[model samples]
Target chain A: MRFWQLASFGGFLLLLPLILGLNDYYIFLTTLILLYTVIVMAWYFIGGLAGQLDLGAGAYHGLGAVVTGYLMIYYNVSGWIGLVLGGLAAMGVAFIVGFPSFRFGLKEVWYALASLGLVLILQKIFLLWTDVAGPLERYIPFREFDPLYMRARAKWFYYYITLGLLLITFYLAHRAKRGKLGLYLVSIRDEEEAAEMLGIDTRRYKLVALLTYSFITAVTGGIYASMVGFYHPILFDGWIGIQTATIAIVGGLGHFWGPPLTSVILLSIAEYLRINLGGTIPGLHQVIFGAILITAILFKPAGIGPYLESLIEKVRKR
Target chain B: MDLLIDFAISLARNVVLGIMMGSVYALAAMGLALLFGVANLINFAHGEYVMLAMYMAYFFSVTLVIDPVVSSIINIPLFFLIGLVTYFLFFKRVINAPPLSQIAVTVGVVVLLRNIALVIWQAEPKAPPFTIFSASYEMGPITIPLDKLFATIISITSLILLYLFLERSKFGTAMRAAADDVDAVSMMGIDTGRLFLLTLGISMMLVGLSGSLIMMYQAVTPTSGLLFGLLSWAIVALAGLGSIRGIYLAAVIFGLADALASGMWDPRGREIILYGLFILILWLKPRGLWGRR
Candidate 1:
């Protein structure tokens, strides 16, 4: 691992006790941030490296959540087993959608629209599949702290679980970024036809990217369902997908460390702002957040990742 | 027999209403189609412009005590100016950027404009003033709301005018040529930048018109743009990216599908049906029915 990666991991460990010592409110916010960090990392794989912006992560996340919830409820399956099953299920679905879409040569807006349409379709299916999920929220019954059930009353437990998941996600993202897979993804992102011309099996690589990204996101969804303790159709809402894409873009798409860093900072700020302004201003934080997003796009189009890298370089030089 | 009759009647009514509603969607999507087809830029904030126009009509009707019809008349040029300024200030700069950058820029504008609306109008849904024409009118066994009828007529007329202008007029031809090949069009001594500005202005004007008409049927709020934006996207894609005629057809089909689903099933099912159609159509016909191959 690089020095900064080590430093980031060390800093996370050091900050753990400080975070745990905080009040329940702060712990809740921190836990939420960690959850989004996992998601952002997952998004970075396809969005940042492959340059195919699939605004349909929520569909996979929601499916994973529902699948894990059902397995635990009916089959007495452990959360760990549920997580694996959910990941596999998500991979299966991703292949079904991603194969036709990528193979048919849909890119940019066409691909974005198709991916978005996938979310909408999946949402409808989920809604109609009333046995698994419906309009009403499906709650996972609170069992006494059981790792098998993935049920816990303490926020700290959820926090550690999410942090662990975030670590795994980071490892995968790092591996992909430095390997031949990463180069192929970047080639596809920059130019698909050119990548194909260069003897790269563009379709196979894209399929692999989709499967990997979906599996990670599905695991995050399993954790998210356990954290929230309930699953509803609203989980599959378009806003969920939009916010994920927004967070990924804001963090600097394609950067190894940018998404997680952006998630921690921006989501923390959002949480703080929400606590301060939510009651008094009513949607003011969203307004300000939206403004920040616009400014980030306008000035720092490459995202905060590049800026952070340069700043670290300058500090190292000193 | 009675059940079948009820279903048939319901289906007929929904189909009619769907056609009317679809016309509005088609009108709303025209500007988006033009921008995407011609400028090669997807304006994510296109819905915000529609919101602004709706608010403008609402403000004039309520604050200035002007007639809603007259307010729409006034809104046309006002929205045209706003469209021109927005394009010149923001959109013109990123026209040459990559699709991702273009998307990012427009999304930024969407966020900024939406937040501005929240700050200015608050989150409350505002109902625009309407006349007797806004009420429902019954003919034979069918009841058609006058306001919806008026909206439909206005939308269809506007679309007809747009088609004529694009097909018959020199400016429209220049705009189409610029959209097809900007560099080639410029090489022919035509000012492509001017064409873009004019196109943006006209596009926004059409969106404003649609927004004003929408207010006659439904209330407007800051968040109202969300549903409309998504629906317009569905329409644009279903119509195929650049085909205006396809948009109209797609809008009608979507409207019928939405209305029938709601009328026959639960109200929420309407959303499911509409989105289902969007995905199914794209899967079956990726290029859209009327889109150029």
Candidate 2:
């Protein structure tokens, strides 16, 4: 029964684009949902399994966007090539940022502060780096909505691209979940000192997790830049990083499907609120998001993932 | 030779200005350090409380026709109540939770406070209609603004008063005891819970006073809390977790660095230098400048 439920859920998502058709607004929203789901899944590796409360989503995502923007604008590179290079750039940055923090034992609050500071530093750099990226929004040219380059008039091309990214990320996440690296990561997250005492190289495994997470998130950032048709330094916003953190926490940390599911529900509500009441009543959606985050943290720290898992267990017992 | 003399004079001016700004930063850091020492929690929403106090000071001056100086005094108790209420409502529950949970709670508070401020104030930067402190006193080539000077004086006086309170008062001793060991402090027949609340209250009061004092020279915006909040964190981190005197010293260093950066480079350059300093300190000396391992 549980297997069937999972299968049906997957089927529903696979059919979602076809069912929604070419309604640009709904398609755009779905593409955003898929994009964020991929990002949040990447976050789960470092934040969930590794037990590192990293707020450096902006660090990788922003870097990827900037790299992609720079490549496409300056070198006349293809957005598809930018996608791979963008992920690599973000991974490189993650290594640089994560190495020092992990090496020096910056965990929990200290780590969070460092990561947040990293994003701020990156933003300031981009803002001041007038040679490559000035304060102005750099636009990506679209040749009558070229889908191959990701500058499409119709949302379908981006939608499929995001869907592909989501599938690949979800597959990788599943492989990690059932693999040796996943076990090591969870143990390290639960008790790092004990894991180290037990002869696990926590630092190496953490770097691996962080690098993988950064690479995938960077790809999403690259695709996001092309989808949006422009790039700005504000893409590395700390608030967006916090939002990703909220999704990971609320989705049930360490749960493979939790982040994506949480993103779907929460991001949908947020977008709906924004579209409906944004002009009529400003800041209400954010207030709701804040209140929900607080309540979830206080009341449901285990998130919907554990609740669902428990329900499955009860059904199996019956 | 003339170019070098002009550069030296400008550098001197920046150093003086930096010291003045550093006093304000110290005033803010004092509250944060007190909270960390006693509460053992880093309030990311520290700047939101400061923002609230600034708005209150602004309202008092604009609506009730009260002087900001007098209104700031009134803010002490009001903000103390605010702190006490906050403790009971949100903080007390998460006091024993994991560090990440504590952080999430505070981040939630930040989002809520910042957005609420945006809704109420409509995101417009506001300043009180008073120019008394805007006057500058010049000594040859160097000019010091009166508002900054007044702010520095107020901050120093508050710091001295705070020092005396912690040293001489009964509750202050109890608060210090609580910080040393919660179980032992409670075992000594002192109510540790009340002491924690008192510490938090005092911290909030200090933030309140600093916020009001800053309104004379700085404009208060809903988003201004982000920069101030991050700076205070940097100061606390650089100063060490519990050392009050270290906070003051670090704040001065931060202010001087910021002043020099802004004078020599640009405003954006100042932020880069400051955040870089914060990261470097965290890496090199996680125990901070004065914190004992």
Candidate 3:
């Protein structure tokens, strides 16, 4: 993390609390953004840094939400315990899916399809598992703004929780990027053959990246489910899978702050477009979303993150 | 003995239905295989191309009172041109980029094209006017829809034609050679770029044909491409990477599995079985059942 990044983090943290008091809608939107940022950051671990196109985050997210929501609703489990257990459950699934994928040489398109298949499979399971979670919606009981219970009245409570998770992710991501694991993962990502030849346990490191990323994303999913007070099988959706990948890519691969930065800009624009034109024009937002991706790929293949970083570096040199 | 006879009869029905459905899948998978072989690109937008062809067939039938089958025939040349233009404009730019970028570019095409269709046509399911042989045919206890029989016949004929083209034609031989070794074919003075463009064009034309074949039975919708697209993905995976014969066999198997599962349980259960089988195949045999490394 650089001075600018730290400064920005500090600035956002300081400003967010003040902004929360202004309006409920702003708080709700910011809270959603914060949650997505956590997801995008988790996605960056495997997608941007490890260089794997695992589209299975939605699988983990849905798993975490289902597990946590189920436990809290039926077993009366505390949201805190549910959060950890949800993460573990998702991690377990990540191993089941990621083990063969990495152990064998499933790279690029195959990996993507495999991950996507996992999401669909999980969604089907949840949809059909009527004894547990079915096509019907499941809701969590809400309490009066109780942060300890993870049941909050005001949206700001969820905002703070998501912010805390974001900070922890930022710290972990920052450390990994600077440390040895980051180098190993990056080497494996850039060229798996050369990395393996150089004695790097490419499969093991890829598994580690996947497991860690899955755990954090699941925890966030639990938080999201609690905040929304409901869960559905569609929680394991293709849209979120695409959105997370898009954010990571648009943020620019291999940049720590890229996903978060892209999340704020792109998601805000998407939300704005949805609100304004969504009523009149069906599928219009998707058209614009795709257009943005095409423009990004055509013009800035390196991504907005690296572009911003270089710009800052030039300014500093001057 | 009665119970046993009933079960046997049901199984036979499913098997026959599966084969019919599988033939359609094979027809779609052939286009995907051709593109993958010649261009080494999976064309995620292949489904959208199919969707566009269906829409074209629908409008042509609705406005001009042409038969759906004939409209699809007319769509082939236009779809081929669209494929060529899309490649030159979008896919050509990302031919050398990493797989993620390649996937992203195609995904963008999927979103753009699908949404564009939505904007133009709305989300309503549309079909041509009623025609003869739209009802089901009964043979003993087994019943098969007439539209499905026609679709299966058309799809099988197209696959056979594709097989002959690849086996006998000069351009087909060139495409096969390029699939095997791009550089070697280029060294032999073949214009690989034009070959790729031609491959994409033909691939789109085939998908358009497949779309029209199904238009007689299946209602055309903007989002129908997504389901068929994923189904084709599963088919391609099951068929292995570049094996045309394997695609046909795999498509039959997939079609059979879908029919049997839905018949035995429910429609949703069929999806679970199909996707479960897909993941299992990817895990156990990444190269597919018949594909060599």
Candidate 4:
């Protein structure tokens, strides 16, 4: 029964853009939502498994977008190469920021603030850095559909790409969770002092989680830049970091499939609200987002993931 | 020689401006100091509340046609209540919950408050055209704006009063004791729940005052939450906990960094310098300037 549920969902995702046939705009929006879903899922590594409240997703994501977009635009790099390079660049930044942060034993709120500051610091630097990026947005060279260059004007292509990335993120998170690394991360999250005393190199494990999460988040940034055909300093949005952490926390802190599920539902609703009410009521969608978050945090502190999972278990037994 | 002298004078001027600017920031951080240091809560929405207070200040000044500073009459009491309300609605639950839940709740409040500002006021920057304190005083080679000067004096005074209250008063002593050991304080027959509420309320009152004082000169947009929130947190991180003087000195350092970065380099680069120095400080001195506990 579980296999069938998983298989059908996969099949549905594969056919989603086709089912919505000519509505390229909706496809584009779905892709954008999935793209963020990738980031939120990747957040499972740091926030969920490792128990760090990292608000620096925006930093890594923006860095990936800038690096990939910059290379593609100026150096004529393939999108695949740009994605890899972008991911690597984000990992580099993760090391630079995370190594010191973990080494200094920064945890809880201090760690969160440090990561939050990372997004703003990077944004400001890129804003003032003129050669690669400046105050103005850098537009990628547009192509109707150059498969060779991996530049496309169609939104469905990007949607499928984001879906692929989401799968990869899911698989990576699954592997990490099931593996030895995940154990250390969980123990550290639960009791850092105890984890350290148990001979776990907590800092190294935490840094590993940071690097993995950052790399995935950056690839999404690369994909985002390509889909939009431009990358700007504003890509380093601290709000994205906050929102990603919010969704992950609300989904269920350490549960797999929770954040991705939550992102799809919440983001689609957010996009819907953005479309319908956004013109007349600018931030109504965000207000709704906030209300949902508070409600979930206050009422379902363990998140809906665990609750839904138990329901699934009961139904399966039946 | 002339170039050297010009540099020196400008540096001196920035130092003075930074100190005054620091005082107002001290008030803001003091609020967080109480909630963070005493109440043992981490509020990601600390900046959002300041942003809300700024909007309130703008609202009162424009609608009531009063000076921005006068908005504190409304801002302080109202925010105190708002803080108490937030305590009940959000902070109360997470006080003992895991840090992740606590952070999530507060970040939710950030999104709610920031977007509410966006919904009601839109994203445009808002400020009164001029206030009564807009005038400047020329002190020979250095010039001081009354708006900032008033902000400094009032901020320092409020902080000092908070400091004395914590030091001299009986209830304040309970609050301090509650900070060190909540269970012990409660066992001694003090109501810690009330102390937490009072800490949150008083801290918010400081946020209200800081917002009103800052509105005398600064224009606020929805994004200012990220700015002031990070700025206030940076001040706290630099100062550590348990000392008003440390917070003041740290805020001044940030102010100087802001002044010099904007004054000497580029205004856009100020955040870089400020946050860069902030991260550097965290790495080097996690205990901060006055971190005793």
User: Which candidate model has the greater DockQ, 1 or 4?
Assistant: 4
DockQ of each: 0.48, 0.72, 0.66, 0.87
Question: What TM-scores do the predictions have?
Answer: 0.91, 0.96, 0.94, 0.98
Ranking under lDDT, best-scoring first? 4, 2, 3, 1
Q: Residue B8 deviation, candidate 4, in Å?
A: 1.6
| B-chain TM-score for every candidate | 0.94, 0.95, 0.94, 0.97
DockQ: which is higher, 1 or 2? Answer: 2
lDDT of each: 0.79, 0.84, 0.83, 0.90
User: Which pairs of residues collide in model 1?
Assistant: none
lDDT of 2 by residue, B29-100 (tens): 899888877778768788788887788888787877766666787888899999999898788888767777
Off by over 4 Å in 1: A1-8, A14-17, A73-76, A311-318, B64-70, B115-131, B220-222, B241-243
Q: lDDT of model 1 at residue B57? A: 83
| Chain B TM-score of candidate number 2 | 0.95
Better of 1 and 2 by TM-score: 2
Q: Chain A: TM-score in each candidate?
A: 0.93, 0.94, 0.94, 0.97
Candidate 1 chain B — worst ten consecutive residues by lDDT sum?
B275-284
Tens digits of lDDT, candidate 4, A1-318: 999998998999999988999488989888888899999999999999999999999999999999989998999998889989999999998999999998988878888889989999999999989999999999889999986676898888888888889888889889999999999999999999999999999999999999999999999999999988999999999888988988988888898988889888999989888998899989988899789889988999888799799999999999
Candidate 1 lDDT over B1-40, as tens digits, reads 9999877877777777888888888877888888877777
